[model samples]
Target chain A: MKASDEERRNDAVIIRTEGLTKHYVLGAETVRAVRQIDLTIERGEFVAIMGPSGSGKSTFMNMIGCLDTPTAGKYWLNGQLVSDLSDDQLARVRNREIGFVFQTFNLLPRATALHNVELPLIYAGVGSKERRRRAEEKLELVGLADRMDHKPPEMSGGQRQRVAVARALVNEPALLLADEPTGNLDSVTSEEIMAQMETLNENGQTIVLVTHEHDIAAHARRQVHLKDGLVEQDFLNEPVETSA
Target chain B: MLLFEIVMVAMGAVRANVLRSVLTTLGIVIGIAAVITMVALGEGAQQRVQEEINRMGTTILTIRPGQQMWGGVSRGDAQLSVEDAIALRAGSDGLLKVSPEQQSRMQVTYGRYNSNTQIMGVWPEYFEMYDHQLEAGRFFDQGEVQGRRRVAVLGYNVPETLGGTPPELLVGSTVQIRGIIFEVVGILEEKGDAAWIRPDDQIFIPQSTAQYRVMGGRDRLNSIYASTETPEELDQAFAAIDGIMRREHRIRVGEDADFNIRNSADLLETRNEANQTFALLLAGIAAISLIVGGIGIMNIMLVSVTERTREIGVRKALGATKRAIMTQFLVEALFLCTLGGLLGVAAGYGASELVTRMAEWDTSVAPEAVFTAIGFSAAVGLFFGLWPARRAAMLDPIDALRYE
Candidate 1:
């Protein structure tokens, strides 16, 4: 088959969900957390999934991140259909493809910044020498080279988040997924973290960020807003530049 | 993940909770110490018995008066006489020699010191039969026994207690047995407890002298020691002696024999068997503590799982499989048990030493007992740690992450 430009463009899409739905049976109540959602995110594109507290944005992000399977419908990542994958298989996909930056900056409290970044590689069965080298490089990338020996508790909130970001990017995952990455940081630190994200994206990395703040969502070129377990709007933004 | 890595990680977790881990291992330590101590006690007893057998020949037999029970109401042991000993030797084949013994508690004095101790009166053949060695002077001969002379052989400790005089100096010294002056002819070597006889504290005199003078003339003998040349002749020699005793005592046939002829080797064998059973029983009781120890590990591991739920969630989200989680907890349990087991071995050594010093008892710990104690602790770890480990592995990651 001769591939057309539009077809080739669609081929670049890293995440595509078709009629995805998730419902939980809580005792006598059936809560539909995510309703028939169809979305497509292409490679090298920065996108923000914006939603309020009960809008099911977190649930949808979980599906896209391979953290949860859809109750019914089709989902694909890097063109591989993963909706039917087993729990263990989905974990492998999450490890190799998705990098999570949690709202709370879930860095292991007892580990050094360098060791925290080395975790993904350790899970990937990398040797100690290689793990150390890659972890150092990632720590250096996030401008925390001197702070590599600091533990999460010992560091400032901003530095700890930066350590989390370095950990997220160390695996060279296909998509950087951050869920309210700046929830615990002050406004100034939030902007500093967004700048780091922008730099990574500018360097040809794909990022999908989940946030409730309009300003934080505006930093991405495209935004998808959700309401009541369904998509409310999808649009592109000019990414109005900000000064720190 | 590598096995070594899992163990290292598990050890790190265990080390982080130092007090709790050590507390969890306490039961295992106690269990292993009990097992080791019991085994050591049994072994020490067995060794003492063996030494006693060597001092007295294995083929030797002690003929004590048998119990006379009428309708299960015991009338105590019957009395034996020297006539029985003489008659057995006269009517016996495969018998080498016999010694009739009679004992009495008496007060003895030498110089300005005095002590109360046992005096054993026996024939000359008794010394050779018991492998008794003299430290100084000579043994009383049959002539002395027949003449009812007042010569006596002092035990090695007799001099040390009476006046602290040396063995050679005690020889030719006159000591009063039952307030009657008897000249010390020989000093016996320091032989410890053997054949249920404490030879180091007693004085030995001729049986004729004891029967006629000390007892005011009585023919009754306390016991008889008889032996054959070889171990193989033991059974036949017992039977011949039994016949002699029966005919002398004039007990009717098919009736309960008046005397009990027991071989030294048989007694030793029975004692060794009883010691084995005692050790095994003690170890079995001790193993229950290890099971209790394993349960402690499980309890602490469960608490740990709850406390580290968020950590488990993070690990699961980082691509750790259920198998990895299971391995981590299992390794943690095994580490605790093995650590406790090793510590218990050292404690058991200390315990045995304490037993030897404080209680004046012999205690020996065997290598096999140590190995078995360690292996049992591992089995306990595996057995009781299973449930908690599986519970940790099966936790839902999302729920765990959201857990407070």
Candidate 2:
């Protein structure tokens, strides 16, 4: 039987990079932020990019998240080339294909949790009712059903992070990108967020997490470590049994 | 749906800084209020002038004596006499109704009440020329004028000045003017003040009675009034009066006539033009204030954009387009300006009402003026909001996100 379009796209690589590079000119010298990295991640895979502060992981993540254009080379998200897209087109790609969860929980501080979760759908041109419904579902999935009306300032740090997670997932994007998601959380809350992400990966959600902490990187099924603007290690980990 | 979300976001941002927003709009409020009040006052003055024009007949002309020049040497003021008026009336060929007038302020007494009042001496045709209607009794006839009878016609407010007696009751009563007793033959209905003429407060008497008895035989008329049946006939009447006056005074056609003829309509039109120029100048000053107000809005909007830099970065990272960001800021500015406009209109209307009540001046707040004020304020919003909105839209998301 001929594969359906959705099935074909699901089988295709969710993210592919060919010699991706980014450089910044600091007066008299050029700084190579990300240098000649070729990478690929298939649908439903959980991966973590681990690096020290100056190891170029943030720059690589920004390029992969469609937040920054590369200085050289190609990037394909969901089988479509996106590295050369214009600023506005990159915004559209971010809205439709990639979901972002930030360490600071980047939810609009003044907006209620539900409103914050509905933002991506708003940019996706979804109807108000459908946006609310999908946002509610995602918030409920993140155990924030009772806190949907609370603003970021009114919520606990972990709860705000969960709200950010819900916001990131509400658009049903092909890739979920989390950059230092548990950076500001307590140990227990960080574990809680990581376990939630692990559950999401088991449910066939493709995830890419960026972090400097080894414990946070351990939650992903595979890990890639970077140093000096180049990948130094790529390895898979055995699934750790949950306490529950 | 996106548009609705954008509008909501803008509303939320404004609400978040309610005090700042209100304070920022104060300039626009004062500017629009000034514009509205100034326009209303100007319009009221124009309406008053129009009413004055209608009150003083547009088809009537006043003949006043100008300086008489002899062989290009300056002479003192010339005189217009009753005989010159008679000559114009006779030579008009049924095209003009002429009246010679003499007036003075004199003490008038009725019983125990006495007041200083204007006494007017005019021909019997004067009432018809001014279209004055009688409230009671009949006007003095030509026979009365010819026989020099001491008959008077009371003006609308003359009864009030003389002990507040009713017009109907005072018509047949005798009033002493300058120590001469005259019977009131008629009372005129109210005629409002028109420019220099206050006909409602003056009492009219026959020109012969005034010349022989009241004015002590002074034949020099103050001025002559000439009227045509239609405004279209004023030019012909003017030429005929000029010819007759020249012939009576023994002046040739090529010489400058001593008498100057003035059309009341033209004089009022000149006054109206001056009023309009003054109104425009005031409005121009008010418009400058509006522009100053627009600059104030621009200054505040730039501050807001700078303060909300991180918020803008978050929105952009969450997939907000440049157009969306621009629209958000623009809508906030537009909303602020429109709110100020509405408040200003209300304040201006209240101020105009206060003026009418306290100063007794006519003021009308036209709906078009209100709408134009609001529309102009909105335009100010768009014009001044552009730079700040553009600055917000062009921000790089990575740099903005990292903004402290």
Candidate 3:
């Protein structure tokens, strides 16, 4: 194949979901948390999935992050189908391909920032010297290189969020999945974190961010808004430069 | 990145909860120490009993008559005669001493002092046979028996009844047995009683003198004391004497015997059996504590799993495999157990020493007990550790991540 054709062929289509659904039985009631949905994402695409509370945005993010299996659907990542993967296989895929940023910045509380960032590499069987080098580089990238030895509890909310971002990017995963990444931060810290995420995306990283705010979703080129477990709209945002 | 990361995490977890880990380990330590100390007690008791039995000496046998039958129809009386004693000594290959004894209670008198005591008629060799030694004066001699002399040897206690005078001073002094004046020849040393009579409180006279003057020349004798050259020939001596007595009395094989023979070997065997029983009991009690310690490990591990639920979720969400989670918990459990086990071994040694000092008893703590105690504690850890590790591994990452 030609190099451009091969680049397109191997362009890291990270998430492809068809008829994805999640149903849970509580007592006698069967609740469908996420209805049938089809979605596709390509290499280096910065996309935002927006939904209000109980709109199935979190459930969809979990499936896309390989933390949960779809009840009935075909989900593929990097040309490999993931819908039928076992728990162990899913864990391997999650470690190698997807990095997650939770709303609460889920870094281990008692662990140092370096240890937290080294976690993915440790799980991926990376050697210690290389794990340390990569972890340090990622922390430097997130502008927290001097705080590598500090624990999560020792850092501020903004600093902790940045450490979590460094951890997410350490493995050089194909996609970064952030679920309400700035929900717990103050407005200024939230803006700072959003700017960091923007810088990461500009450096040729794919990002699928889940958020409820329109302003947060507007930071990305493409936005998909969900209402009541169904996609309400899918459109590109107007260019920020033209609007200014 | 590999299994070592989980091990390091476990180490970090233990380090963070140092007090809790130490307390948990203490439970196992106590369990192991209890088991070890109890076993040591049993072993010490066994050794003490055996030593006590051995201190009584060997090669000494006691014979008593068989029970009387209805209408006296048994093989006459079981009375051991002087004739039988003499025949036993002459026929036995390694016989060192043989004496027939007759006992009777009577008033013994010296001047104004009078005391009722058991009188024993023993041959000259009886002094060395039962390890009896002279404090003052000498035991009766062969010439006294040949002449049928009325000479008595006072045991150490009998001198107290005679106003505490030396036996030599009392030697030519007259002591009347049943109103007959008998010259005191020797005094025995203060050897305490066996199972029955006190040797120091008894009075000894020549067999011939007691036979003729004391017992009125009756043909029947009460019992016999026989001593072999050494312990090795004791059984042979017993068999030889039994054979001579039976033949002299014209008793055939399979006929009812006239006497019963008892030896120190029987007492020794009984002491050994009791020791074995004690050891078994101690081991059983120790095992109970070990089981209890194991349950404690299980309880603590369960609590740890609950406490670390969020950590597990975060790791799982970060792509940690279930095997990694399981190994983390298992290593933690093992570490706790091994630490407790080592401390327990030290505790056992100290406990044994304390017991030995406080009670004045012998307590020997063997190396095997230390190793076994530690191994048992670790096994307990492994056995109880599995459930909590599995519980942590089986956690659903989605539910765990959302758990408060």
Candidate 4:
């Protein structure tokens, strides 16, 4: 059953991490990529993680995305103790619960937009017929329906990013993870991508974006800023409106 | 991914660089072709030897004069004679037929063509032993042999040497051997070559006629050919002849026989064994090429895995398991090998045919060789494809994704 307006305030939290820590060994030197931190992200919330280089934002996003495990802490994704899962089990969790969107729009160079969008569902064991239908819907949702046959190299940067977005949404995952989504785009294309993000957020799609630019981070309703591998400031902002 | 999808992806990777894929599989193709062609040649030679044995009669045995050594081999060998054949015929219960044969080399002229060739003289039973076919006219009968008539049966090639005339036309021609004229009474059909012996090259005459007329009434013979009614009776025939010869010649026990016996069936077995060994040697040498082809696949696959590192990472990020990644690469290698194998089989078939056409070498391609070659090629693919697949599967997605 859909949650009514009264139960919206008690919406289930989709991502929760307690004392998550990531440490690296570089030839007798210890680098803490992520320090002990507790973070909770509720469903349908549009959130962004802001940090400079070496601030551990990417590392933190990798943990939340189930791409890497927390070294000595607990991670509960959709209420599962994912920190203790094996690499294969973590892969299952990543496939079923997360859809990653990289900054460079990491579409397979040789595959068409349609095939690129079908990749996540392919890993999920979805049959080709249904996979095609769902991928086409996601491409239409991201306004790249006409570019289904185009390869990444054939598309412009904005179109490529949209195809990536369609691929991310095709699986209907629990969370959308975008790392520096607009770092490689010009201002006009960035605004266009941010507007698409806003539309997705308005449709109650949960988002966790990682970016260094404040203007890009401003697109998310909530921002978690990091410094020295720890959360420095967490606040809410009025969402930037890009009319065009 | 589904099996077809994995195949499609692998095929796509191969198709992306068609030239490299073809060149990489060239090693496998050459390897398989070599194996098949060699086996075909060996098989062809074996069949030819077997046919020669069959044609000569498996139950047939030839007895040749054996040498006797005395005081460091100063003594001469014991020679076979008509009396020995008569003794063998009378004493050996297992003997079906015994024939005494004599041979002499002399120049023969029919009209103006004169050539020196071996002329064989034998009993009427020699025709039965060799299963001779008359292309024209008739064989000189037993009456002619007893009467010592000057009659000869021309072999298939004798007419060619005499006048390049057809065998049928030479049935009534007169051939003079060593200044004595003999009438050609029959013409034997062409038997071609068997192993190294050319049966078509010699003419035949009655033993009595040859001894009394040509050799001045000599009674000695060059060999004695004996045969058994059935193949199972050959050993008994051999033993009976040995016993009779020993008693007739007054040889002591444990002494070497005065003649050597050669069974056609045993020769056939030896030749077949030699052919088998030759086939094995050829296959062993050709297998090296398959291994070399496998190495080529491994090398190219390793390069492919490296080149597709980023794509592999993306697939892993999109939730592909290590098994899926591994299977994708393995299927790719399998494709390369099986493709090579098929091409090799075709090439092998063509090569064998080419050999037959160009050199007139008898070549037979056994179906088993084709199947074995294809099967081995697939195995090579699986074996060589393993390392690169495991390497791709074991790549850390996080590191791979970050790789340029």
Per-candidate TM equals 0.83, 0.88, 0.74, 0.88
For candidate 2, the TM-score of chain A alone relative to the native chain A? 0.95
Q: Which stretches of candidate 1 lie over 4 Å from their true place?
A: A1-13, A79-81, A232-244, B23-59, B70-76, B87-92, B106-117, B136-153, B157-186, B206-209, B212-217, B228-258, B261-295, B342-352, B364-384
Q: How would you order the candidates by DockQ, starting with the best?
A: 2, 3, 4, 1
RMSD of 2: 4.1
- Model 4 chain A worst lDDT window (10 residues): A1-10
Question: Which DockQ values do the candidates obtain, in the order shown?
Answer: 0.41, 0.63, 0.60, 0.58
Candidate 1 deviates by what RMSD?
4.6
**TM-scores of chain B, in order:** 0.82, 0.85, 0.68, 0.85
Please give the interface root mean square deviation for model 3, in Å.
1.2
- Look at candidate 2 and tell me the lDDT of residue B200: 94
Higher-ranked by DockQ: 2 or 4: 2
lDDT of 3 at B151: 90
lDDT of 2 by residue, B256-325 (tens): 9898898876667766676577567767766876788788888988998998898888888889899989
C-alpha RMSD of candidate 4: 4.3
Candidate 3 chain B lDDT trough over 10 residues, lowest sum: B68-77
Q: With candidate 2 superimposed using the best TM-score fit, by how many Å does residue B184's alpha carbon deviate from the native?
A: 3.3
In order, candidate lDDTs are: 0.85, 0.88, 0.82, 0.87
- Please, what are the lDDT tens digits per residue for candidate 3 over residues B1-404? 48778778888888889998988877788887777787677667756665544444578776667754434486455677888778877777546477888888889988888999889988887787777888877888878877889998888999898777766688768899989889887788888654354788999998888889988887577877788768998778778767877797666776766777777555456546755665567567667767777788888899999988888888898888998889899989988898888888888878888988997667787778778777888788899899999999999998888877
Q: Candidate 2: deviation at residue A242, Å?
A: 5.7
